[model samples]
Target: MAQLLACFRRRGGATASAPDEAAEDQQQAAPGPVLVELFSSQGCATSPEADAVAARLAQDSTGEGAVVVLGFHVDYWDYRGWKDPFASSAWTVRQKAYVEALRLDTLFTPQVVVQGRAHCVGTEQDALAQAVRDAPRYPAPAMKVTFQRPNPTTLQASFTGSLRSRVEGPGGASVLVALYENGLVTDCGRGENKGKSLLNDHVVRRLEKVAAVREGASARKTVSGTVQFPLWDGFRATRCGLALFVQNAALQVLGVQHFDLPDNV
Candidate 1:
């Protein structure tokens, strides 16, 4: 994991020659959505506020770039008193990856990672807004995704797209697809948030790496793959959505697109 985090540094350097104006213009014209990941927990007393903040950000679409918000419930605080039903150890590992990549001293709840480039206290709306505003934007991936319910317990997704970024370094780039649900209400019966009713939006239920963009990949690389997800008990296509993002070796997001699962599928 340390080795993986080592590859996650900011991507920048001087070019050998002048930049191409046309390419720059195209990039600006199709700036990608900003991914705002909130590492929170129902076991934490302060996380509810951050969760609310994330919900607000998810609804905001009037800006220059779209904001994609995801709520990751970490399980580290589950032992305090009441166990958070939404908490998962996998989510904790994800947050730790960011901690190592960002060189942070320790982990804490109500944390926000913006575009995998900036981190701030999740409760700090001003800081989160500033980070979003300051983060660099890339063009959205031109991908078409389709879904199918292979069985009552599974969902199959297939995607194809031309990735525009150059994938370099040992870690390469990954095509990650996240399955998320909205309009969740959890009643915390124990733990730090005991007796409080918690509302969560964009909660990531499952995250999978569908494919990898190899090192030194070309701009017109043709990539396609099918991934299967074991659906949760109360899964409803109408209440769920899929978010696909291409992340480079440095763990920086290059491009992202969201799809609303068809009700019939």
Candidate 2:
């Protein structure tokens, strides 16, 4: 099995998009879909626009190159009066980790991290798109995922993925997966966004680091992990799905992808 996985990883291919303003920044063809992380807050007045940018990218076609966008609502702004129910301390920790890994002085909302390589103010629409275009492409990992409802209040899913060589490096790797919901709206009671009903997309609900890739493992490392959604009953949103990110030892990311659940199964 290990030898077979290694052979498959070595056979992975790279693809180049047509050179244009959008594709100029990339060094080579991406191996998989680009992952975009939006660290935002409902308390932020400018978060709406940046949130929309994520929506646009999520609908894009991958035949060109797939893109996965996740909105991580941070908790610091909760004290502002209008607590973003979607906000999580975990998300804040994730952002802070990036600040130190990227050597930034501090953390801020409305920030977008692309492929964990490049980041910019989330509201910078043009730069966000450029960053995605400029990101080093990795192949969309070969993913297999399925969901089941064993009993009420319990949602379970099992997912597996095989990483590609373009996204791997000397440093080892880690796989992080998240559960997100779409078409969510928040009616702010107090704060800068008070009196407004805000819409958000791909709002992450749960995230977990499931596995670690060894330093000398198969370039096409394969990992299988399970994700549980405990508060599943409370969320009433369209297009609930799962997303995965594979990062290297330095916390730099290789790439990411998303898997959506069907209405019936």
Candidate 3:
């Protein structure tokens, strides 16, 4: 893990390119959170193994500032036999964008994309392990956000974060916050698995970008905004979380953070 982290340290490109105090400050301000995204479907028999990988990574997300997992059930495979209740066309579109971004020839089930930069077969445990360890090359803006459930169905959020002027470049930056669900199970009736049941974690329910960051002319740039989400009965029994990430307009993830929802609240 240390070796992987060393590889991402700003040497020439993403890391500290200049041997100066300003460059060192930029490196220190970058938040180090890894990201793991799994493109899967209920109809794909191999997807369960990938799903398990995501769940395991999410478990570590809190411990080592490890990979923040997101399991996206795409709708393309719904026609195979049993429709994935969690599958969404929007999710499929997101996957497609990755297809272009990552330079993949096409899409496939059980594909694990790490840090939105590297990818491997989800079931390839060894490769996936290395990918997760190697994430965090792109420095994230330092950020903080809190979720408050005002009532049973509505959630209000307050966010505060600072972006380094060096990291955002001249175009500016933005952060995407998402409400995700976990420990979700679905019993497949007529798909490839027939009678099998599927359990998943880090399933995204809703996501939106905060307003464009406030790019200050000084060394310390920042942004702020408020957003809300409507909770429903479908989220009643499961564990949920809020994840926030900063990214440039080019679609590269800069930094990320995740907050698990409390049942007592």
Candidate 4:
């Protein structure tokens, strides 16, 4: 069995380094799907135009290829007239790190990080389109995840996989398990979504760390947890994915996955 697993891993082109390095290299090697990270705030009045542009780009079609867009609600604008409910201090710090890494003095409301290397104003239509068109592709991770639901309201998922690493580094990597609930409606009386009943897909409500993958080694960790939703909303959990990426000392996402989550759960 072990021998078969090893063969399978090799056949699938598994890597030994952190997934981020592998992914970065893969993107450089081939034209893969572009992952667009939009940094915006609900409190910023200038963000809506950028948000609209992002939404449109997400819906565009480039053959069978598609662009992945992630909306990171920044909290820096909370001190204004409204406090964004989706804002997080971690996100604010993350943006600042990007600024420092890129050597910039100020951060804006609609900043977009493209492919971990390029940054552009989110509302710039020409720049956004060009970035998407010329975006480099990365290699997809060989991590296979299985989610087991013992009941209607609970799920148990176990992940076992290896990411291609660039070097033989020490310390196991960190497994970040993020759970996003789709079809969320918020009546925002204050923030950016204010006065608008926004229907958001892939809305991340819970982000949890299930385990710590050891360094210089591949991991096969299993985490069991339950998410109970009341019978009133009849809302079901739609998508769940595990992003196995390598982070620098600054905790920036060197590489990431916008993987598809199981819909039945």
| Highest lDDT scorer | 1
Which regions in candidate 4 have their CA more than 4 angstroms from the true location?
Answer: 1-31, 61-65, 148-156, 164-177, 191-194, 207-235, 239-256
lDDT for each residue of candidate 2 in 98-122, tens digit (9 for 90 to 100): 9988889998989999888889999
Local accuracy of candidate 4 as per-residue lDDT tens digits, 208-260: 55445444443223322323322223446333233334333433333343444
Model 3 RMSD, rounded to 1 decimal: 7.9
State the TM-score for model 2.
Answer: 0.82
Candidates' RMSD to native? 9.4, 8.8, 7.9, 8.7
Question: What C-alpha lDDT do the candidate models reach, one value each?
Answer: 0.77, 0.72, 0.69, 0.53
In angstroms, the error of model 2 at 78 is: 1.2
Which candidate, 2 or 3, would have the higher TM-score against the true structure?
2
lDDT, model 1: 0.77
Clashing pairs in 2: 30-137, 31-137, 31-138, 31-139, 32-138, 32-139, 32-140
**Each prediction's TM-score versus the true structure:** 0.87, 0.82, 0.79, 0.65
Q: Where's the lowest-lDDT run of ten residues in candidate 1?
A: 1-10
The residue-by-residue lDDT of candidate 3 on 1-265, one tens digit each, is 2222232222211112112445557466555567778899989999998888767665544434556777888999998888988888988998888899888899999998877778999989889988877766544444555556788887767676554434444565667887888778888899797888788877887777776753323335556677888776766522676667765555566666555454444
Looking at model 1, the pairs that clash are 82-191
Among all candidates shown, the one with the greatest TM-score: 1
lDDT of 3: 0.69
86-192 per-residue lDDT for model 1 (tens digits): 78899999999999888899999999999888899999988988898898776556566666777889998888766655564567799898999988998889888
Question: Lowest-lDDT window of 10 residues in candidate 4?
Answer: 1-10
Candidate 3 is scored at a TM of 0.79
